[model samples]
Every structure is written in structure tokens, then in C-alpha cells.
Target: METKIQKWGNSLAIRIPKSFAKEAKLDYNTEVEMTIEEERLIIKPVKYKKYKLSDLLKEITKHNIHKEIDTGQAQGKELL
Candidate 1:
């Protein structure tokens, strides 16, 4: 697919064809990551980050097992 960079307000934008957008699952407000490699530029949707509960717990435990509790900071806060 070929696209032309056109002027928009103060930025340059590319008009992607509907067919290409649909095949790539592109939509309004979709978050994308852009990168350049060699002589090519790449654009891809940003994937959600995943975390395993067990792995997170293990990391926290390793770093904070013997940490002192800060009771003063937690005492007067009203959590909404």
C-alpha cells in the first residue's frame, strides 16, 4: 500500500486505506508504536502489557521481605 504524507493543522499525517486499516485492525484512537530500522519505518499497534501474579509477588517478596513498615505515612491518609 502507498500513502502520501499530507499536512494537518500543524502536523503531517498519512491517510491509510480503509482496506489496509481493516486488515490490520486499525481504528480511531488506536495506540501505535513507530520505529525506524535501516531504511524502513514501521508502525504497529501497542500491545497491552501482561504480568503474572506469581512472578510479581515473587519480585516484591524478594525486594521487601524484611523492609520496615512506614506506619506514620499510612495513618492519616483518607483514601477515596
Candidate 2:
């Protein structure tokens, strides 16, 4: 697809058509990775990393000394 670079604020940018953006599953504020291979330029969406809160909590508890604190004194002792 051919596109013309136009002035955008302080930087130059090419406007991707709505049809092309929709076909590429791109929306406003979407993050994309750009690269050049030989004479061709490529643009791809960046994938996000997925994490689970429960897994993170379990990992933290595995190494936590205060997770089994039963009393205020025990907690205070652990704190000190």
C-alpha cells in the first residue's frame, strides 16, 4: 500500500486508512513495532505480556516470612 507522509505537529506521519486499520485489527492509541527488511518496511502490533495476580501472590507468599503471622506480637517480632 502506498501512503504519503504529511506534517503532523512537530513530526511527519502517514495516515493509515480506516479500512486498512480495521483489517489489521488496529485502533486508536494502538502500539506497533516498525522494522525494515531489505527494501521493505514492516509494521506490526506489539503483543502484551499476560500475568496472573494469584500466581504472583502465591510466589510472594512462598518466600514471605510474615505470611503465617498469627498474633500482633509475632508480627511485631517479625517486623523488628
Candidate 3:
């Protein structure tokens, strides 16, 4: 199917037809990863590997420690 790129506010946007999106199981709020190969733009849905917190914590050892990540400055009621 062919689509035309149009202006959307400050960015260019294209509408994926409903039939195509439905066939690919894509909808609003679905995350997609976009990459450019040679001269073509490829977009595909992001597949996330599910992990449980308990399973993740099992890999932590005594030598491992949590590092503080800077999340910018606190906003609203967030405590430092």
C-alpha cells in the first residue's frame, strides 16, 4: 500500500491504514522501533522480553550494589 507523508504540527507524519495496522496487531500506544537501512526506513513493533522482579533479583550477588541514577531534578512533590 502507498501512503503520503503530511505535515503534523512540527513533524512529518503518515497514517498506517486500519486494515494494515490490524493485520499487524498494531494500535494506539503500541511501541515501534524505527531504523534507516541504506535508503529505506523500516519500522517494526518493539518486542519486550518479560521478566519478573524476583527472577531479576536472583542474579544479584553480595558484590553487586545499586548505583544511584540521576533523574534530573525533582519536580512537584518528589523528595530528593
Best by TM-score: 1
The global C-alpha lDDT for each of the candidates, from Candidate 1 onward, is 0.82, 0.82, 0.90
- The residue pairs found clashing in candidate 1 are none
**TM-score of model 3 (CA atoms):** 0.65
What's the CA RMSD of model 2 in angstroms?
A: 6.9
- Least accurate 10 contiguous residues by lDDT in model 1: 71-80
Taking every candidate in turn, the Cα RMSD to the unseen true structure, in Å, is 3.4, 6.9, 6.6
lDDT of 2: 0.82
After TM-score superposition, the amount by which residue 32's alpha carbon in candidate 3 deviates from its true location, in angstroms, is 1.8
**Residue pair clashes in candidate 2:** none
How would you order the candidates by lDDT, starting with the best?
3, 2, 1
Q: Tell me the number of clashing residue pairs for each predicted model.
A: 0, 0, 0
- Which structure is stronger by lDDT: 1 or 3? 3
Model 1 per-residue lDDT tens digits across residues 1-80: 56689999999888988887888888999999989999787888889979999987878756468777665544455554
> Candidate 3 lDDT, tens digit per residue, 1-80?
78899999999999999998898778999999999999999888999999999999999987896787899977878884
TM-score, model 2 to reference: 0.55
Tell me the spans in candidate 2 whose CA falls farther than 4 Å from its real position: 51-80
For model 3, the local distance difference test gives 0.90
TM-score of 1: 0.67
